[model samples]
Target chain A: MDVQEAEQPVKKAALSKKESKLSTLTRELKKGKHYYILMAPYMIIFTMFTVVPVVVSFFLSFFSFNMLELPKFVGWENYARLFLSDDIFMISLKNTLLFAAITGPVSYIACFIFAWIINELTPKVRAFMTVIFYAPSISGNVFFIWLIIFSGDTYGYLNGFLMQTGFLLEPIQWLRDEQYVLWVVILVQLWLSLGTSFLAFIAGLQTIDRSLIEAGAMDGIKNRWQELWFITLPSMKPQLLFGAVLQITMAFAVADISMALAGFPSVNYAAHTVVTHLIDYGTIRFEMGYASAIATILFILMVSTNLLVQKLIRGVGT
Target chain B: MALFQHRRIIKKRLNRSIPVTIMLFAFLMLFGMFMAIPLVYAINNAFKPLDELFIFPPRFFVRNPTLENFFDLVAVMGDSWVPLSRYFANTIIITVFGTVGHIIFASMAAYPLAKYKFPGSRVIFSIVVLSLMFSPHVTAIPNYIVMSQLGWIDTHASLIIPAMAFPLGLFLMKQFMEQLPDAMLEAAKIDGASEYRIFWTIVMPNVKPAWLTLLILQFPVLWGTNGGDFVYSEELKTLNYALEQITLGGIARAGVGAAVALILMIVPITLFVISQSKVIQTMSTSGMKD
Candidate 1:
């Protein structure tokens, strides 16, 4: 009886503690109920469209599902096949990495440099230049104009120009030839790449105070490069980071340009990318499980690379 | 004497050297030309007569321009089973609903996220930032399943609903809203104003530039969406898809295709030009806070 009495108070104590924590959470939620209400519409749709799909993709990566039968558990077989057996995937991974490696950094620097130069212009010229630089990106689906330029015949612009100049005796199939497809794709991608990040950089440049440059001059900064490194870069670190995120994502996701210009499944899969591979398996082959695994890998690659870049960007001005 | 001597500082020409300035201008002109040429060609191609289009040593500028391609485009669009207006209606429906809903919802959400110090706010914002790092292609298959489950596969909801939650608009809105002073909100609260009233009457009107900025960004995206995968019904397809079909009519239709491409390109560019200053103003405050 005495032992039961002692244990009863202990049980009550634990129960009361848990209840208090629960009550505190409820109290906090009640206090912020209006905020919750305000955020509900966007948060609900966002979860349904964005967040839930990512979680489902991760889960489905472990199962073999074709939307016909039950999703059968496959463990690591899909991933194993992707790594060891799928030669096309390896090619795609290589192509995607190469594409991202070249376009990502080049476009990022180009965006900043162009914005910086354009910023130095008079306001009238700056706006004109902004529109000129930004026109390619905003002009939707006009990338096919590149097709007319690179069209594999003498009637095509490049071929016509080359033949007219006697630079080449014959027209080259720019989009068809394996040797030129990736580079052609890269060129178009870069042309379209000075997009959101460029605008952001221009805006970032505007936000930098004028006094900082004058102060830097008095502090014995030698040149424009020194001023940029010590003063301008540190001041716009936020925009730099923002631009990095936009560029990195656009860089890694290079399927649309490849598909539009080089043709889907380009000669020998020369322009094949991770996203195109995902599209192939998911839409064409209907191999949902394998495609999900590919997506999971891509998701990991993008997120990890962004985290690394963010870490590196933190050291920019220091 | 050196310390007391006044240093002349020209604000406009802060750190310019003549040779460097000349070199910069030359570089700018070269790169700018590379960027401008294709756009120029597309516009010139649209105005070219069919004969001029096919001429050997294809010209960049039209020597003799005509509206024949535009007339041909109308004729071709007239011949389709679905009228051109149906596609126009669909595109309008998608873009208007998507852009409006995105602006309203993102602003509403950003208010609490920017102003309130509540539980789960940090976590929610972090998720949004993380979502921006990856493209939607990764979620395509799963999203297809989701759309089918919701019976939104053949409907405009598939396009409109997903677009409303596009993380970029929300991110920008949040950043811009953070710059709004807390004292303003506090003053409203002292006047016994409710959160909803304070938000609707006070916060929104003050952020007009941000709204315009979101419009400029979101308009082009929704305008150009072809509704490729989620939509299947012929009637439900967008203007972009229809135009794309016209362009696919091969070499004989090149002039008409250029006309279509020109029409497609002009709307968004025009919108950007009209709103350029406002967009830049909003973007000035769109800096991430670590």
Candidate 2:
């Protein structure tokens, strides 16, 4: 009888603790009730489009569904098919990784370097240079000029130049040839790559305190590189990280240029990417389940890379 | 004044090495030409007559520039089932609504996320950051479903509403807003100002650069929207889609295609140029913290 009485008191004490926790939560909620109201509209839309879509994609990856019929349970069959039976998937995965590996770092470095150099110029020249550097990225649909340049006939600029200079016996099929298609696309991508990251770097450079550079000079920093390494780079870590994420996302999503320049399903899938593969199944073939699996894999790839890069960026200049 | 003079001297002395300077200039000029030549060529192509366009060993510059292509574009556009003006109106409607709506909602959402730590704040922010890593390509299939279920498909709302929720704008706006001094908000609160009043009058005014940055960023995106999967009606199509269709009209329309490209790019480019300084100023504050 004494043991039962003691246990009852302990249970009552635990219940009171739970009640307090619930009360505190409600109190906090009440305190920030206005914040919740402010956030509601954006949160609702964000939830519907961005958050819900991602969650749905993740869930749908496990089922087989076309638009017309009910989704059927498929277990891991779609994923297994992607890894095991699908040769095109392997090709796409390889191409996407290769494309991202090349474009991501190259474009990122190029953005920073151009911004850094442009910052050294006088303001009038700086603005002019900024406009010049930023022009191609904003120039919509003009990358088709690259198509004209790399055209197979001698009339194409590249072919005409090479032939005129006697560097080639015949005009090369730049976009059609498997060996050259990826490289051509890569070149064009680099040209168009100095985009948001470039602007961000410029802004980052501008935001750096002039006093810091003076302080570094006082501390006996020898040259521009030292100034950049010790003072400038560390000050703009946030911008650098921001640029990295943008570049990584863009690098992985290289479908538009490839589709336009190299032709979709380029010469034997030479320039095929994960997104292109996704579009193939998702939009054209209506293999929603398979496409969802592709998307989920891509999502995992991008997020993991971003996380890894974020860690590396945090270690910068330490 | 003396300190400023001394700083200038120090900067001059610590200037980049001569060899590095030369190398950098060379690279700058090289890339500058590479970037500018295509655009210059496109501009030239737009003014080229038909004969010049098809000339062998394609001419870098048009021997004779004319407004023929522009005239042709007008004529061709007149033949379309939907008027070119309708496409323009559609684009204007979409771009204005999408960009403005994004700035307002994102700023509203960003205020609380930036300044206060309420329930689910960290979780909500983490989700926003996570959304940034992946491209929208992943979300297309599911977003289409969501749009249709909401009865938003085939409507301008499909494009405008989703655009309002673009995570990067919120991410950047929040980052910028965090830099706003808490003391200012606290003082406002002490004055008995409501949180809504604080957000609208004080916070919004102080964060002009951030919203301007959002405007510049979102403007180009919305301006260049092709209304990919969500929009399908001919009347509902954007200007970019219309121009793209014109360009796809085959070999005979090559001159018109170049003209179309020029027209397609001109508006956003002009917007960037006009707002370049303000946008950069805003972007200066657009840094994310760890």
Candidate 3:
């Protein structure tokens, strides 16, 4: 009885503290209603389109939805089937990881290196070089031109050249052949991967303060290597991090190029990726639950890789 | 004196090595060729006579160039139910509205998050950054569901409205807006200006470069959109979607396909050329320092 009596006041005090905090929050909301108003249009739409959909997809992953019937709850079944029994899922996963492994780092480093080199030229030449480097990325569906270049017939550019040079006896079916499909997709992906990050790097290099470089020189920094390592890299951490995230996301989402170059469900599924697999299930099969499961796995893979890369980027020049 | 002379030689060599310059130039030329060949091939194919296009030992450059492909494109497009001009108009409308709407909404949201110390600003900004890592494909199925529910599936609103709040533009705008001085806002506040007034007069004008950067970045994405999975009506289709269909018409449409490809490629490339100078200019001043 004494303990109960003693706890009542403490509980009352805690309740009062909560009330005060709630009141302060209300006061803040009332004072800053304009900020909410300013952000309301975008926030409302963004929450509806992006945030809610992501949550819905996450929830849908645990069901047996076919979009025709009511979604039936089937906890862990979709995921189990994905991992244990689905052979194509395994293939898609392997292809996606391989694609990301090749294209992600290669394109990232290429973007920075080319941007760095181009930064050395005079402004007019730099502009020209930027266009040349950036043209392929902006050219819509221009990768389809590679189709003619790698055409299987003797008329094909690569085939004709190889045959004329006596490197091969017959023209090889590059896109149709399982051995060559993945490589060709990776090559084209790399070509197109220089879009945003390249521009960001160019901008980043251009923005480096000239005084800082001169100061570094006076402080005993010798050669361009030291300048790039200690000064330029450290200064452009934001752009680097930004570029890394974009590259990582793009690397994981390799559907469009793969689908375009190597026909969907390519021979032996050589060019099949997680995204293409998801598209097959989601759009073609209408297996919402399984597709969501695939999407969830991809989301986890991408976010985890991005987090790891972000950690590595933070340690740059330390 | 001899040691000093040796050091001078080394420094001069370090500053501008002839061999290194030659190596970099060589690399640039090789990479540039690799990047430019497909585009050059497409441009050349657009002008080639049909006979040349089908020739064995496929040539990189056209010996005989002509405008028959363009005329053929017009002819093929004329046979379609919807005129090619409608597709062009639809594309222009979508891209213009999408880009302009994205700029306005993104800047509006970005300004408050960047400048004001509101209670949820940090949380909102963090969400924006986190969303940057999410591929749109992951959300495509659910987004389709949401769009159907909103009755936006076949409408241009499906493309334009959702794109207006794209996290990338907001992220870029917020980052760019952070460079604006706070004192300017304070001065406007002291002069009896509303927040909207300040955002419109002071903030908008000051961030012209960021606006151009946003335009350049967003324009190509929307311009190249192939009606996505939303729009279905023939009249509502974009030029890119029409171009894809024509290309898929097989060997008969190859010449016209090349012509359509050139048309699609040229618009964005021209926009990039016109805006890239300003983008570079703005970005030069807006360096992201640690």
Q: How high is each candidate's interface RMSD, in Å?
A: 4.9, 3.5, 4.9
**DockQ, model 1, C-alpha based:** 0.50
How far out, in Å, is residue B53 in model 2?
1.9
lDDT of each: 0.90, 0.88, 0.86
Writing each residue's lDDT as its tens digit, candidate 2 over A201-295 gives 99999888878887788889988888888998999998899899999999999899999999887899999999999999999999999999999
TM-score leaderboard ranking? 1, 2, 3
- Displacement of the residue B247 alpha carbon in candidate 2, Å: 2.1
Per-residue lDDT, model 2, residue B14, is 66
Clashing pairs in 1: none
Query: What does candidate 2's lDDT look like per residue over B1-290, in tens digits?
Result: 22112255444546457677668778887988998999889889999999999998778998999999989878876777897778878989998999999999999999999999988999999999989899999899998799889899899999999889989889888988888999999999999999999999999998887777787778877887788787889999988887778667667888887887887777777777877887777667666677
- After superposition, the stretches of candidate 3 with alpha carbons farther than 4 Å from their true spots are A1-20, B1-14, B281-290
Q: Using DockQ as the measure, which candidate wins?
A: 2
- Expressed as tens digits, the lDDT of each residue in B210-249 for candidate 1 is 9988898888888888986989888999888877877786
Residue pairs with backbone overlap in model 3? none
Question: Residue-pair clashes per candidate, as listed?
Answer: 0, 0, 0
In candidate 3, position B207 carries an lDDT of 89
Instruction: Please provide, for model 3 over A94-203, each residue's C-alpha lDDT reduced to its tens digit, 9 standing for 90 to 100.
Output: 99999999999999999999998888776677888899898888777888888777777887789999999999999999999999999999999999988778888899
For candidate 2, the TM-score is 0.94
Compared with the real two-chain complex, what DockQ does model 3 have?
A: 0.46
